[model samples]
Target: MSHKEALPKAAFQYGVKMADGRKTRRTGVGKRDDKAKLDRELQKINQIIARRKAEAADGGGVGTPDYKRPRY
Candidate 1:
């Protein structure tokens, strides 16, 4: 394949954050009833969900912070 064809076309994807308060993606606490930190982190995750909903409603969606548009 040509170099231009092999290059990535876009660098960002729009989506909600699904990581836990541990700040790791696709992970969650093992037990639900025995940790204060888990409770706090779950609350924080809920806050993030609410914020993302608000952004979607307002059409404030974006992909990435450092992506520069291709010059035409």
Candidate 2:
């Protein structure tokens, strides 16, 4: 009979337990992708905050109401 090669193990393995008693798996995949995605999200949030601050400084913020309009 011909010899067979051993199968490789799984890329991910059981890691740790969660606070709710659930099991978790740890993997080395997609870490860089996740970091890139988080960085992009943070950049977008920062840009929006900066734009809002600039608008507030220019007195054109949404919180500023038109004084010419009569209040009900």
Candidate 3:
């Protein structure tokens, strides 16, 4: 039988119980949303930082690297 067709009924029963609980963590509802949003923003900032670092590495003028002096 397929794995999808072999799931235990106890799992479904637990899911029902978890859904019925107002503060059940098993459902993972509305948990850490702010942290997730912050992570997304951090990822964006890191992407921008990487782009700037690459531009600096190619001898283009955006800003001086932390370990280098300004030659201009």
Model 3 scores a TM of 0.43
Q: Per-residue error at 24 for model 1, in Å?
A: 34
Where is model 2 more than 4 Å wrong at Cα?
A: 1-29, 61-72
The candidate that wins on lDDT is: 3
- Per-residue lDDT, model 3, residue 45, is 90
The CA lDDT at 67 in model 1 is 46
Q: Would you list the C-alpha lDDT of every candidate in the order shown?
A: 0.55, 0.63, 0.73
Candidate 2's displacement at residue 33, Å, is 0.0
lDDT of 1 by residue, 1-72 (tens): 555545343421212232323345444554544587678989999988888677668765366343452211
Which residues of candidate 3, in runs, are more than 4 Å off? 1-31, 61-72
In model 2, residue pairs whose N, Cα or C atoms come closer than 3 Å (at least 3 residues apart or on different chains), thus clashing, are none
Candidate number of the best TM-score: 2
Worst 10 residues of 1 by lDDT: 11-20
Q: Residues 1-72, candidate 3, lDDT per residue (tens digit)?
A: 555666689998888887888455544545677779889999999988887777678876547665685432
> Residue 53: error of model 1 in Å?
0.5
In candidate 3, how many Å is residue 20 off? Answer: 7.1
Candidate 2 displacement at residue 59 in angstroms: 0.9
Clashing pairs in 3: none
Error of 2 at 70 (Å): 21
